[model samples]
Target: MNLEELLKSIIHQENELYNLYKLGETFATYELPSMVEHFKWLAGEELRHKRTIESFLEEDTLKGTAVIDYLDSLSLEPYFKDERAEPADLEDLILEALIREKHSYELYDRLSQILSGSLSDIFKMMRQEELKHAYRLKILYEMIGE
Candidate 1:
């Protein structure tokens, strides 16, 4: 509700996302050709997001009111959709990645609307990055599906 509480909640979610991506990279590295680089890159993005979120707590210039329970309405289904899934092929892997990116993108976009000023700008940037990730996954999925 207040700044501290909001930051704690956001930081927790960001850390969860970061860990998920890190786990994804770890699994990707075990593949034959190895998807280490791609997953690693995405994981790095998530790490950056985590750091960015932490900064908001300390950034006085950008400190506006944070929307408490902002993510309460957002479905966690897509983010966890393939958690127990084992990818049968590269296409499957790409589909799972796409789901993750799309969910993150949607969250950022919605949060941006609820945020104001510089914080909104940051969320918008994150949303665009996630969109790019989704596009990349789509291309990979198409290529592997053929």
Candidate 2:
């Protein structure tokens, strides 16, 4: 896949994670109130990231090869088999999210360096947001004594 297609696929995977997190929040039977709140907030932030990526695409003035199909095929569930099989404890979940965010940040950062113009800016912003998410997850993990 080309750069645009790869970026779109990343965004699509983020969207899937956003939805999964939302569902996880709804289904979670957290023993601690703070843990419940943390997951809910994380889910919201994931959705916010999804919206940010969508907005960036809308604002992209330069048209490139559209790759909606490739994006549509991506899923986040299979990436975390342990979490998918049995829901992790709050700290474990946060750490898992942090790892995912780190991977995404690295991917986007590499893409940003290779790309130029608005596309580069979009990837940079995405990488920044992923890092922010990772930071938040780390904080939450520490708070939960993980």
Give the whole-model CA lDDT for all candidates, comma-separated. Answer: 0.66, 0.60
- Itemize residue pairs with steric clashes in candidate 2: none
lDDT tens per residue, model 1, 84-137:
445565556666666767877876787788888877898999999989878766
Error of 1 at 120 (Å): 1.6
TM-score, every prediction: 0.66, 0.64
Best by lDDT: 1
Q: For candidate 2, lDDT tens digit of each residue in 1-146?
A: 54355446556767656655564465445444555565677678767766766666667633442323333434423432323323455555555566667667776676566567777787798789778777766776576653
Candidate 2: which stretches are off by over 4 Å? Answer: 2-8, 23-29, 52-86
Local lDDT at 39 for model 1: 63
